[model samples]
Target: MRPRLHIPRPHRRGFLTAAAGLLGAAALGGCDRFAASPMGQRTLKLGEDANLFVQRLLLTPASLAKEFPDSEISPWFKPNGTIDPPDRAYKALAATRFEGFRLRVDGLVERPQDLSLSDLRALPARTQTTRHDCVEGWSAIGKWTGVPLSEVLQRAGLKPDARYIVFHCADTMEYAAGGEEEPETDTTANPGMEARPEGAENQASDSQAAGAEAPADEGDEAQGIPVRYYESIDLTDAYHPQTILAYDLNGQALPVSNGAPLRLRVERQLGYKQAKYIMRIEVTESLKRIGDGGGGYWEDRGYEWYAGI
Candidate 1:
């Protein structure tokens, strides 16, 4: 049964603001040490524990973030994070309008799933308008539609050992070295998608139209290659009623700039906490095994993992 495509918008309301800049900056200043040094790592662990305990203790587990009335929606909701993913595979999927895209749910599951775009949209879909508060002193309200994360997990048959849900995306943040150009996009790689128009520049136009501007640099790894972008949340937020794998923005198909095909909208937290361009859902017993022993790309860069609002 498809959940309502348009749940009645909630009453216009305000959400409490959290002071995340100072704390997040502090942790980020020493993010590498926070993960590398045994003492720093222990401190981070303590901080995460403190954050989780305090948030759960202070509020009901099912309490939801405020959902705004449709009248309150922002006319131009900005897409701040990775607007365009430079992956050849992802570009091919986008070229085809994502008919070939697949959302893989794996790791520590009774039945792993490889769901296509249609498969996900067919499931119950929930739409909500909510404020997205960015740590960088900005906010916007958007209506997001997708399957509740809990529903997907239920279908996956998660194991008791699962503690965190990791969102793997197609984007990669690679710094451009002084003179090296980023690799050109491969527009014709996937025969599934129609051939790119003359000089379309890989997936650039698609992403730009979708609200993302492709980077000018080559962004190739030989110059500077960082890990792929990813994020994770504990079971608590992962199972929240408002937490969803958002696929549509303001009733239309999600834009490439806004993490086309799929993204996560965990309403209770700050903006960066929402992962975009999601490709896979990996259930794991702990974050230690993931990249750099931190739960997310930003976490690996020294930002705190549990960013509660």
Candidate 2:
């Protein structure tokens, strides 16, 4: 029998905390708008670049992330982000327990190859109990087993020009809904209500984005589009020993609730940086064409790209 991974129900206090967080989300939830705006995106990019520069200067090969003993692994590790990807291809793989799943390793590499589940397991593997920190106020320790990403990159023969390793994932976060009109607070009363209400344009855009349905909404996220989710990291983090494409968690085939098949476990960054439902690994020197041309899915939504903490 497959090992069972349990998730506990939140208590009353936890529920209240969640409710409070949701209320605060409205005022703080303009990430999508910030990502979409040319000015806003440029500003966020500067911040990302600055953060990356600082991290690089302080980071060293010897600066290892903290690890815990097996005894410290949590009794339950609740899945974050998209648990069951609604993608047809991902569904098919899950149906057969991902028997036919193959992780495509391409994008600007000298030796591009598709590594199957067995192929990944056959490679040298490292198992470590590490804590996953989420932007949300919660965390958990899980023992993950997978091959070091550096080993795979070495075999793939990374091109010298490749600077960033972009992770294309299967899970989509939102869909273009039907007739969900952008809420407009037109300030042009008789064409004399000048000045756009002081950032009215920005407010209108943000309000409309809030109406966008998440991927888990009724049926498909949208008509036929997949809710795109992806992330990117520097080659340095890609080659980090702790960074691995995990296929097994807690001593079992990675549960569907926690990114089955394969997922990127970027140990040094926040949970969102660990892109789940991993599909492809693209190596590019620039982030000019990766999903609205930002750094990651959340980053595209205005979340800090380099969530290194």
Highest-TM-score candidate: 1
Evaluate candidate 2 by giving its C-alpha RMSD to the native, one decimal.
16.1
Cα lDDT tens digits, model 1, 115-179, are 99889988998999999987666687989999999899888887867778999988865443433
Residue 76 in model 1: shift from native, Å? 0.7
Runs with alpha carbons beyond 4 Å of true place in candidate 1: 1-48, 175-226
Worst 10 residues of 2 by lDDT: 185-194
Worst 10 residues of 1 by lDDT: 8-17
Clashing residue pairs in candidate 1, if any?
31-302, 181-218, 182-217, 182-218, 182-219, 183-218
What's the number of clashes in each of the models? 6, 2
lDDT of all predictions: 0.72, 0.69
Backbone clash total for model 2 is 2
lDDT of 2 by residue, 1-309 (tens): 211213233355644544454444444457777556775545545555555555555777436789999899776675666655556777777788778878888887888989888899999998988999877756879899988888788778777577888888876555544523222222222111112234332211111232432344333534555547788987767877899989888788787657777888988888888877787888887998887776877766667778888
In terms of lDDT, model 1 sits at 0.72
Output the number of the lDDT-best candidate.
Answer: 1
